[model samples]
Target: MRFLETDEHDDPILSVVNLVDLFLVVIAVLMIVIVSNPLNPFSDKSVVVIENPGQADMRMLVKDGEELREYESSGEIGEGEGIKAGVAYRLADGRMVYVPEAPAGGASGGAASADGAAQ
Candidate 1:
């Protein structure tokens, strides 16, 4: 009966149990912060995050669907092998207009002007 009546404060394991509880609370808070982040991986929305913009060590994170792509700058002007697909112009009203080039050997198409109107 004396063993069962031992003081709880005198137990050596009590301190360890408290420490474990503190760590569990800390981990829970961290998990909540990660889940609430806008760029969380579990999120379905696509996002683009640029780090160290315009610097030599610049990096870009592009998240599309479930795929995440990382791009690091090489400290040089980037050159890509691709043809121009369209032209964008700023109208007097500060609206952007995009004019897509017609495919080769195809009839000229009307300019799909801004505001979803055909010109």
Candidate 2:
């Protein structure tokens, strides 16, 4: 067991493990920086961005378009409001579905023959 740990104080394998650990930490920190940046592809200020990806700290950012609205970190359960556009159902063929938004009772009126067929 001791040999596996290190043959001496300056073991090359041990140094490699330490270097790998350092690199891992650096990668983790870089990931955090990228996610926190506003220009990041996955950065969403409106919705909650988990503080540490998985470790939620009850902190959130509310964005309105390009505007950076606010940050809430009360560390308490919160609720938000938004207009529900529509629903979606997925097929069994590994495809996605997205139902479009429409006004209430709009289906019949929208398809009632715009050319005035009844006339």
* Candidate number of the best TM-score: 1
Candidate 1 lDDT over 1-119, as tens digits, reads 77779898899999999999999999999999999876898999999999999889999999987899999998887688999988998999987788888899887777776688888
For model 1, name the residue pairs that clash: none
lDDT of 2 by residue, 1-119 (tens): 76567546786888999999999999999999998776465644444343443344444555545555445455557689978876555557754455556777776222212233321
* Candidate 2 local distance difference test against the native: 0.59
Residue 1 C-alpha lDDT in model 1: 79
For model 1, the superposed segments whose C-alpha errors exceed 4 Å read 1-5, 78-119
Task: State TM-scores per candidate.
Answer: 0.56, 0.32
Clashes found in each candidate (C-alpha, N, C closer than 3 A): 0, 0
Candidate 1 displacement at residue 27 in angstroms: 1.4
Q: Name the lDDT of candidate 1.
A: 0.89
Cα RMSDs, all models: 5.4, 12.4
